[model samples]
Target: MHREIGPLRALANGVFCLGLLGLAGFGAVQVAGKNWQVQDTYHLSAAFDSISGLEPGGRVFVQGVDAGVVEAIVPPSTPGDPVRLTLRIDARLRPLIRTDAEARIVTQGVVGARVVEIRPGSAEAEILPDGGVIASEKPLELADLMQKASAALERLDTVAGSAEEGLAEVNAIASAIRGGEGTLGRLLTDDEPVNRLVQLTDRGEQTLADIQDNLDALKNTWPISRYFTRRGYDDRDLALYRPNASRKSMTISESDLFDPGRAVLTKAGREQLNSVAEWTKEHLTKKTEVVIASFTDNSLDDLMAERLTQQQAEAIREYLVDNHGIDSAGWFRSRTVAAVGFGRHRPRMISAEPQGTSPDRRVEIILFTPQAAS
Candidate 1:
């Protein structure tokens, strides 16, 4: 053995050493990436509702810096208990890991490897003790999204079924009429009978129209108009009245609201409107509507009365919405804040002689509710 080594033997020895060196280097690199330089690892525990896809040996970062590794996940000791995970953080960084640190399982990149990230708490906080239970945030799970989607689909299916049933009923009624099954069908099918029926309907309609006209006339009668003014029917059919449709009303006189012929509201009017705003916010539901109607006297004739009333209504609307935050949407849900001017005379209210200079030239704020909630 002491004799001179052969050239082939020496070459084989060199290759063997290089192979050993390469293997060691590869293993060291893997260990370093996994444990972040592999110093003494202090174990910290945390609880999560769900970790998503976290696994052992996954890298852990504190404040986005390389810090530790995930060690183990312990199944709940009791039912309903959160899953506990043991985290091995670098001992040197222990001081930086405060008791208030929160751990969250997250992906390195979108669709990349998963890791545990610790939120470094305030520097003034006390250091977390060894084996301390840290707080954790659960990552969003696909199962949760799927559950919500399923619930929404169930609701949509119910609506679709109801709509289909409604359509079917409508079709059945349409088909029955087309087959001359009802009185309406006969009117459409038999010419002589239909003709007689048409005449009867015409007569009946004319009779009702005449009655309506007469009622309109009586509605303008002197003392009766006073009651009508108090009750804002606005051409409603007394036969089919629902008292609950309109809940309440507040009337502000034109004299109190505006100065003489000006359309602008006076300071006192603003104060009155502010009170209305407070009442609406406190008592009115989101589905209630506000109706503002204006009236003028017959002293200015038809056209001028209508125009002045319209302008006054507009002015009141601008103040309520611009200054008080009333809605401008529609007839429903705090909407369609209607403003109508009838000049100095509202026939239904000022029967014999118009309230040419009196409080009839006023705006009424009416609250209309669809139906009272049970």
Candidate 2:
């Protein structure tokens, strides 16, 4: 009985030892599978405009040395096209990676793993510490570069075609203009037009010469004599040409005609003139009151106040003659002459003493026959 009891205890002990060995084996396997060096790895993140092809578990290298692997590739949080990728690398090589160090995706041999490679920048660059990020030079994937190059080539082709078309159109337009095919054609090709222009120029010259001759003949006459030949009178009718030879004399009653100092006529002088005109019309013969309200003074303030010019005043005079009721008589003479002469004589001296009186500023005239002498 004692021998049988000892055998049973030995069997139970063997079973318990086997069980412990099995548990130890499982723990070892878990440790081996963990594979990550916790204290050694440094973390960094890089952003790309577009990460078309990249995957986790891709190898990370520093100047060809295996440093780390890609941890994650995060898509852009926003709507625009951007991507962010995270990497974990060993901390021991952090001093080798400068702040200016760049990261890029490169392939191993022919069938090697895709890797995140670092090209250590200048010696002047600061060494990148553990978990510090180095800038990523964009990954050079052949397919993406090819696609962009293809698009650029297409745009270049389009621009070249447009430039060719523009050149052709410009050439055609220039050819047409040179050939004189349109309205410009007649201007360039017609010879009769040139002849007609020459004839017109010659006629203009002849007419101008005739006018100059007539002017020269008129100037030869005296100051008070007529400068134009009578319309109905001819050379044979020279004796019949009663050339207004008699200088009709008259006395001026109004004192404003000769002011104290100034030569220019005044506004009050103009009003007094009109008054004399009214009196003459009420009691005199048929004579036109041609009152040209001429403003010839050189005063900028007066021009501004009136806001009308000499040209405008002349236009008003023309309008009155053409549209209004001012009559035209054959001969012009002084109102003083009319007052003293025989053609329905009437006279009145218009007073000059009035408010807002501009002195010696206007003219009043009356028409009369020389035969009607006082």
Candidate 3:
């Protein structure tokens, strides 16, 4: 009976140890995250001058959509160096991010934690590649505001002191006049001084009129005219910056923008793009968008045809981005530039000739001008 009891006691200890191991494993899993599955995402990085309150695990928003999270905050090497932030963004929403997209540190509330907000660059801009390093802008913090306010107060104090001195000087002059101490006192008693003061007032008014004339001349010039006369027309200029104000569409043969069926840009293509970029940059506002669509011959396999067209469109977009930068308002009169490949699906301009000709292989650039097309 003693030997049987000894064997049963050993088995009971083994069972108790297994129960403790199971509890430890469960605790580890719970600490990891609520769901054990890993999310499908891509990585992006940005450098900021200072991210004072940004923390790891902060939320990232894209145009108000919760699109990603901050993964880590890397310390700068030197005191004045920029801090690098790692971001884990959704893979599917990659296209929304363009080169012009900007990252900023934003606050939850008056005293809440800080989060990063990503404003999408443009609807027509090229998608940022995975693991790309983008630009970042630092938001104004409470500390910075306080420092500015303090400086302003110091200036106010200086101005107040100067004003007090000015008042004292004016009082001294009045007292001198009352006592008839100087030339000003003599002028107060003479008609010649009054005539001189009238002459000085007339000169000041003429000087102001000349300055106004100079500003009007500047407004009529090429560079200054754009800003001063943003209103180009009469009250009917309601369509100046509207989305559908003046829509213009044109189709360029693949030969004009690219080699036959190939995506490599030729000399003429570059020239065409330079002109287009300049025109688009000048006319496009923040809200405007530009779309570049590519086409291919229908004779090829459907998949290959679609893929080729897309590559062509992407090639054009790449050129535009590299030369023009991301099309957005923040980046110097930029507009959102996007690209799509139709693959012979929508051939608005049918080739009058044979099916083998490469006219079907073309690119269509649709421009949405903010102002009326002249």
Tens-place lDDT digits, model 1, residues 1-374 = 48998999999999999999999999998878576555777889988887768887888898677888888888888888988888888888898888888888877754688888888777778999999988887775546645655655565555556555555655665686678776966557779755654655565565555555555555554345545453333442221223556456667788888887778888998898888777765646666666667775556777877777767877887787888767634331235465666575443422122234436567777666678657
Model 3 scores what on Cα lDDT?
0.70
lDDT of 1 at 12: 100
**Candidate 2 TM-score, C-alpha based:** 0.32
C-alpha local distance difference test of each model: 0.70, 0.50, 0.70
Candidate with best TM-score: 3
Ranking by TM-score: 3, 1, 2
Q: Write the per-residue lDDT of candidate 2 for residues 74-93, one digit (tens) a residue.
A: 88888886677788877787
Query: Which residue pairs does candidate 2 place in steric collision?
Result: 265-360, 265-361, 266-361, 268-358, 335-366
lDDT of 2 at 273: 46
Instruction: Give the TM-scores of the predictions, in the order they appear.
Output: 0.36, 0.32, 0.39
